[model samples]
Every structure is written in structure tokens, then in C-alpha cells.
Target: PVVAAAPGPKEPKKGQKLSGKIAQIGDNGVFVSFGGRAEAVLDVAEIRGEDGNPTKAVGDDITATVVSVGETVKLTLKGKKTGDIAGLLDAQKSGTPVEGKVTGVNKGGLVVRTLGVRAFCPFSQIDRRYIDNPQEYVGKTLTFVVTTADDKGRNVVLSRRSLLEEEAKGQAEELRQKLEIGQEMSGIVARIRPFGAFVDLGGVDGMVHVSEISHARVNDPNSVLKVGQEVKVRVVKVEDLGGSSERISLSMKQLESDPWETAVDKLTVGEQLEGKVVRVVDFGAFVEISPGVDGLVHVSALAPGRVEHPSEVVSPGDAVTAWVTQLDADKRRISLSLVDPSERSERTPRFDRGDRPPRRRGESNRPPKVHRSGDPSDGLTSMGEAFQRLREQMGE
Candidate 1:
């Protein structure tokens, strides 16, 4: 009768969107205040996490849709459904995720089918990695986010890379927590460079320096490591670069026992062992007595005679028997002798008698008498007299 019932507070229609502040949180639901004293109630189940705890609190600004409009409004979060364009549009507006199937590969990107709607995924947005063969993605189902969706659903853009990066970020955090120095891990060699090889461990990569590829000397990493080869490595170091990036140092040699630890026990001084000459220098030849163990055969010790260069006695790849003369375990050094120990000459005392005693004032100059197997005092007394005369002459 009066003014057509005053429009009944202009009730919002179902599926209509509204922005408001969370007025209060109750045991069963939360009340939101919108424009002109309009209020809506949201179900507690919508805001509760998997642990059965509320995710939202009072005074927080929230945007929700009107699910039902009666004496009081019932609200729901956007993008709750994904089977229709309305839901997809809501996902695009709210930055939510959706599922799609890769239909074909185009020059620009990938063709995706979602909710019976055609969507384009650019090559760069198709994956976190550079797509070398886009054909592999065809007929594969994947999850993506609706980056752009028009109201008419005529043009839609999807990004699987964004979702992949987010997932990798979380996985990277978990890996970093579990990784530690000296921890051993199995990985695949992803690439080889002159300096090192990059190994993929789970979702991260670590570098294995050429020197660390094996216990033996490594001239080129490609010779020992190839791409797609599986390897076992030890984590020598890990440096966090912040924001899901880290630098890791790995060593394949560290996983093996050090040869030097057993070299001293297995190789005894004066014992002869067969070895191969691996390298030759001006001073000595390096011979590999055992795997990852080397001993030096000096030029002077190559033979009983004088020698100028080590190559003359032992060339590279020469097989020879060597005597272990000195083993410096602390310095990881081994001194080898190519000349047999039995052939070495015994040292003897040599003295010149001309440098002995000079003539005394009244003494006759003559040769001293020699005795064989005589008393020890007789020989000692004559030697002592000669030394005294020599000292007196030197003082003059």
C-alpha cells in the first residue's frame, strides 16, 4: 500500500558478487558487511582447512558470491565449480587453478581443451623448461591456471608453467631441508662442460668438478661423464641462493675409498713391485703402482750409473719392477728405485796419507809399519800421532 513496499532492501541475486569486511566470526559461520547495511553469511566449512581449523578471521576484507538471497544472504567463494565457463571465468578473476588437456601443438604454443572450451598455452607458458619437442605434450592431461578469460569465453589463455613453478618452489624447500653436506645421493648427469659436469639430484642440480669426477686425474669431463648417465655422488657443499635457488658442489671421487690410506700398508719399503710408467719428467718418472697410486723413480736412482733424464730409463707405458725405497705417508709421496738394492755398492772409509803427519825436527821420514789383526791400541796410537802433527802444521 505505501510506496510499493520500499523495494525490500534491493536483494542481491544468486551468483552475484559482493565485496565486504568480515563483520564477525561465529562457531557455525562468518557474517560479512557490504554496502548500505547489506550483510551475508558464509559457511564455516568453506573457510576451514584440512586440519578442521578456520582460515579466516574477523575484520578481513573478503570477496564472495551470493549463493542464495532470502531474508539473509548466503555467500560462497568464487571458482567453486569448474565444469562451466562461469566457473572458469571466476577462476580467472580469482587466480584459481583448473584442469585441461593438451589437444595439439602449434607453432606459437599448445592447444588445450578445458570445459569444452578452446584455450591456447604459449610455448613459454606450457612448462617451466624450454619445450624442445612440443609434440610430446599432445594428448597429455595437465593442470593449469586461467590467466586470461573473456566474458564471452571466446578467447582463453592458460599457463601450466606458473603452476609448475609454484609446485617446484615447495618441493625445493623440502629438498633443501633434507640435503646436508657429506650426504650421498644418486643422480643423472645432465650436462658436461670443460670444467665440470652438472648432475640432476631430484629437482635440483649440483656441479661435479673435473678433478672430482674420479680418483684418477681427469683431463676432460666428457671422457668420464656423459649426458643422461647415472652417477653416485657425495654432497661436498651446499649454498643457498635465496628464493628457491641453490649452488651445490658434488664429488664422485669422495664416494670411493682413498687409495693412499691403504698404499702404505700394502707397499713396504725395500719390496719390489711391478708398475707402469704413467708420466715422465726431467727429474723423475711417475709410475702407477696401484690404481690411483703413483710413485716417483728419480733420474739418479733409475740405475746405478749416472742418468740425465728419466725417459731414457722409463718411457710412458713402460712396465718395470721398482723397489719401494721411501714411503712418505703423510705427504702421499713414494720414492722408487729402478736399480736393484742388491746391486748397490757397500760404502767404505777412504783417507789420504799425504794429508797425515808431517816430519818432526829429529824424527826420520819413513813409512809407518802396518799390522794385520794386531792389538787395537797400536793402530789407535799411530793414528792419534798423525792427527796431532797435522794440527800443529796447520797452525803454522
Candidate 2:
């Protein structure tokens, strides 16, 4: 008879303590065969920590506390073992906020990498303001808070802009206090509005008014200044015009040459200039000889030929060569003419229209004509007679 070797060491009974090497590991559980009639099944969770990540791997011989007796035995490795000090230290450090760089962007949020770990930053948590383009964050580095972490789920949520804004606000306030009028500074144009441009001056922001942009008229600030362009500006005014509030006005035109002063020397009577037609009105066409210096060319002086309106002769922005016919220095008025040559030629007559006949010495030098009102018989009443007749009719 084949001797069935005596049941090896009478395998530890169910609910009995057991110690064995982990032979196989799978998604379901770990199998521990201890020479018993049945194999013990230790759940994957029991082999791992609360995070669902296995603390011990295959081939790691561990002692587990037997919790039940059945075809499948349940065991707890943690119950049999003490807590890990190394893991506690790692947990403490992981919870601390860290710096991260944005690597990618998705519809859900931004993907940032920090400490060799991938983190997700939702759009709402990215910044204090709404972000239209998350891709802009790519390649930028920022600080982030560890909001959530799950080793088993492999999920890590982070936030950076929140931390940055908190730091930026403090620095901005400090810098704002140091700003003063007439201070020269460099700044980036952050936003352009109808009235002005907002420039980020270091950590603070200031306004460059539309009128202070250039000597030339600015209909819109964006036409000459672009967002993100760096420019130097001088602070013009700082006003505490209201309660607990302040206003900062900056100027770029003050840094540039004044067009009015530049044109002063060139502006004089009878000096000719090439001008650009700026506007046409019924009375005249205004031509810009220089940026801010414009002269009026009356319709009567537009051409030798009569023009009903200035617009019939010249349109806006047209280039025209004309002579400065007149200048009023005190009034800063300049008159241009296209008919200067014709006017001069007309003044110098080649020959007069002969001599006039001499009149009689003492006779009244007046022309004789029919006097209708003087003669009442002509049916027209004299002024004195009309007044007398009205007075009589009124019984005065």
C-alpha cells in the first residue's frame, strides 16, 4: 500500500496563527499552500495597505493572522505587523505643497509634473480669473498644493495659481505703495481699452491715457499700442481723488518730441509746404503739413476755377502741394492757397482799360433817373405821405 506520508506537521488549523512565504500573487488574491488539504487564500487587500497598494510582494515570506476557518481563509498582514515609520515620513512630506511644471493640457484640467509624480489641476483651481487657454500654461512652472492623493487610483490633484496669486497680491501692494508721480519705469501693456492702456509696471499696474499716447490723435488705444509690448512711460499724476482710493496716470507722449514745437520754426507766412489733406468741409479743406500742424485752404483759393465745395477738389488723406498764403501767428492759423500764382498775375495788369472821361467841374455829379416815389402822380407813395396817411387813418 502506498504510504500517504503522515499529514505534514498537521497544518495549522483554521483560526490558528500561520506564517508562510507568498508563492503566487494575482489580481484575486495571494495563494499560500501550507501542506494542508486546502490552500489558504489571502485577499489582495489584506496583503496591501489602506491605499490598496501591496506592502509586500511575491516571494516575501510574511506572517499573517488567521481570521476564519473555511475553504478560503482570510488573513491580515497588517494586524500581525506594526506600523511603518518610513511610510509615515513619506506621507508627511508628500502632503506638503511643491513646485511643478505644466507638461500638458486636457479638457478636464492641466497636467503638471512634480517630484516625479503626475498631478492634475482643474481649471477652476488654476487661477483667480477664468482661463480661456489652458495650453498657455504649458512650459510654465508654478507652485502647487497637494489636494488629493491615492496610490491605488493613481490620482493626484494640484493647484498652483492660487498659491501664486496669494504671493503676488502681497508683493503688488508693497510695490504700489512705492510708486510716485514723475517716476520713470518700464512696463508691459497688459490690456488696451477705449480710454487708455493698463500697463503692468513691475508688480503694480498703471494707466496710460489715450491722450498721453502720442502727438497724433488716437481714436483707439489698441491701434498704436499692443498688449504685451514693453514700453517706457513717465508717471504724470497720482491722485487720491476719492475716499481710500487712488489713480495713476502715465504718459508716453511726454517722452517723445513735441510736434507743435517742432513745426513752429517751419511755420511762417508765404512759406510753401507739401501737405496731406486731412478733412474737407464746405468752407475749406484742412491739410496737415506736419503731425499736429494743419492749415486751411479755402474753397475760394483752391483753384482759379470756382469749386462749390472743398470735397469736390480734394478728399481726405490726399497729398497736395500748396503755398502758405497767410499766417496769423498769435492765433496759430495758417491759410494755404492753390491760386497764389494766379492771384499775383491778376494783380499786375498789363494794360489798364483806357482812361475815364472827365466830369463837369461844378455840376452835381449824379446820374438822373425816374423818381417814382418823389412824384405822387406816378402811383407810388412817398415815405412822408404814407406815414401821414396812416396817422390820419388812426385819428392821431
Candidate 3:
């Protein structure tokens, strides 16, 4: 006698979303029970993290869309069977975000399965900036907003960029309303441009200008800052951009104790100390006597004999013993005289007003002084320049 096979449960249509619990696991894959005869298999690799551990377990509730209907159904982490054209229209009209799974990467951009429809997300719309490796997004679940939902070829255009920007804007506005000037906070370096490092403050980006990166002079920001570096910064400026958006200027050095706060007591006049020659300018060579502290060695003090140029006596990076001749704490100036090692202890430095050559008529009786740094009067532009540089980097 011949026997006929019994009929199985009805097949689930492709793109149809289903929620169920993991019923069993084996070498082939995980079998998900649809609470009925129909069961779908999820790739074992798909439900794992970097640690190679399963993110789901037996009886764990999981939601997936029927990607293929065969003898055994296949499911993916796609969104609410919004794969219907009507569901997409509702999302487009409501500005609601829909979930999708990146099925694959193509030259145009990513091929996404959302609302049960195949959508095209241009490469530019994948991120706020250029995306170098689009493949990294494959098999990953992400949220997106419908940009163009025309029913032609079932053309459904989506943009993760739009969703990200909207979220960022809302977050930025909320932060601005509560963010106070002079507030100190920690942030991650998000982007580094020619002018400065853009720090991500939760959602808003604040600029840490090149001039404010540190107390030490930095010609290249890249030399000190790297993307994703955590830094403590102080909010120095906040300005409204007429609406929800605003600009924030932050300073790293402000969070640090100004090195010149104790300059007067630290560098006593006539004291001899060894320092490294940091810079050799036309007027003199600047020596770093301490961290974030530089003193100028005038050309006249380069040697016992007349010196035509400061460089003629000391080149940069030369370690030398020099005597403090003059210090103007209010002006943040320190004058040093390079002396022969043998004569360092023989005589007091001839740096006081009593030892100075007589001033010509109309000249101040004070000793001549040149301030190369610390006062902020010259050598470097301050906040205005910093903000301008940031503007150029932003194209604003």
C-alpha cells in the first residue's frame, strides 16, 4: 500500500516580519518557532558579537523578517513588516524612522531591506562624512528615514544621514539650552582639521582652537591630538546661531593651571639655571626654563663680546646655563643672559637699572625689554584668530 505525505503549514511570504522564540540550536543554525508549524532559521553567525558568543539563547524572544521562503524559512533582523508600500508611505509622511538591515554593498551605496522593500541609500547619505568602507555596514541593522518613497520599481530611497542629522540637531539644541559658559566637561575628539580639533560634547561639537590646544606653542594640531582621544575642556564661548543651533568654543589650557601664575616667585633675578634653547628669533633665543615657561636671551647677553645676532651665539636645542637678568611678572617677560660656565659664579648678572648703560635723551630710565611670549600682546593672535580658523575649516 502507498501512503500520501501530509500537507505542512502555509509558507510565510518573503519580507513578512515574524516574532518568535528560539526553540532549538544545532550546527546548521538556530531554529525559531513561529508559535506554529512554520519555523525559520537564523544564521548562527548573525546572532553573535565580536567575542564570538551568541547574543541570543534558547527561548529568547527574537524578531526577524522572512527573507526567503523555502522548505525551511530564513529570517533576518528587518523591521516591522512595513515592507508594504502603504507602511512606507506612512513613515514618509510621519517622519518616523524605520529599521532596516543592510543586505549588501554596491557601487551606488548599500542595498537595504526595509518595510519589505528594497531601497537604495546613496553612499553620501550613508554618513555625515565620506564613507570609505561601506562593507563594514553589511549585515548590520540600522535605522533610517525615508527620503524618497516613490512606488516606481518600488523605488524606496532611504537616508541614515538624515536620521543622524535630525537626532544630532535635537540633541544639540537641548544641550545648548542647558549648557553654561565656563562649564568644564570631558569630550571625545571627533574630527581634526587644519585649524583645530572638533570635540563631541554628547551630541554637539565644540571647537578647541589651535591656540587653545595647550600652553605650549603648537604649530601642528595633528601632532598633539588624535581622533577619539578623550580630553578635558572648559567652555570659553557660546553664541546662538539665531535658532536652535549654536557655536561653542572650548579651551584645553584653560582647564590647566596657567604656568605663569607663579612666574614672579619662581624665576628670581640674578639666579643661574640651565635650560634648553627652544627658539632662535632675530632679537634673541627663547629658552624653556620650565614646562610651558620660556625666557628670552637677548642678543646683547649672548656673550661678553658684541653679538650681531642671537643665533650667532646660541642655536636652537642647545642646552645652556643662563642668568636671569630681568623679570616682569605682570607682562610675563623673563630676560636671561648666557654666561660662560666658568664666570657664572664669579659676578652678579649686570641686569639691574644701576648697571645698565645710560639711556639716551627721551628714553625711559627702565632697562630695555622684549617680550616674545606669555603676554598675548604679540607673537600669536588670540580667540579671534582661533574662531576665524575654525570658520574656515567649517566653510562658514
lDDT of all predictions, in order shown? 0.81, 0.73, 0.81
Compared with the true structure, model 1 gives a TM-score of 0.46
lDDT of 1 by residue, 1-396 (tens): 556655445567898898889998887778998863467998764675422346888999999999898788989888743237787799998888888888777678888878866678899897655555788888888999999987645578999989878887787667778998999999878778899999877667789999888877677888877776789999998886344566899999998889889888887899999998889999999989987899999897897877888777788889999999998989999999998888864523247788779977878767756544435776544556667889999999
Best by TM-score: 3
Which residue pairs does candidate 2 place in steric collision? none
Cα error, candidate 1, residue 113 (Å):
14
Assess candidate 3 and give its TM-score to the true structure.
0.53
Candidate 2, TM-score vs. the true structure? Answer: 0.52
Q: In candidate 1, residue 390 scores what lDDT?
A: 95
Q: How high is each candidate's TM-score?
A: 0.46, 0.52, 0.53
Q: Which candidate leads in lDDT?
A: 1
Off-target runs (Cα >4 Å) in candidate 1 are 1-169, 243-246, 311-317, 344-396
Sort by TM-score, top down from the best: 3, 2, 1
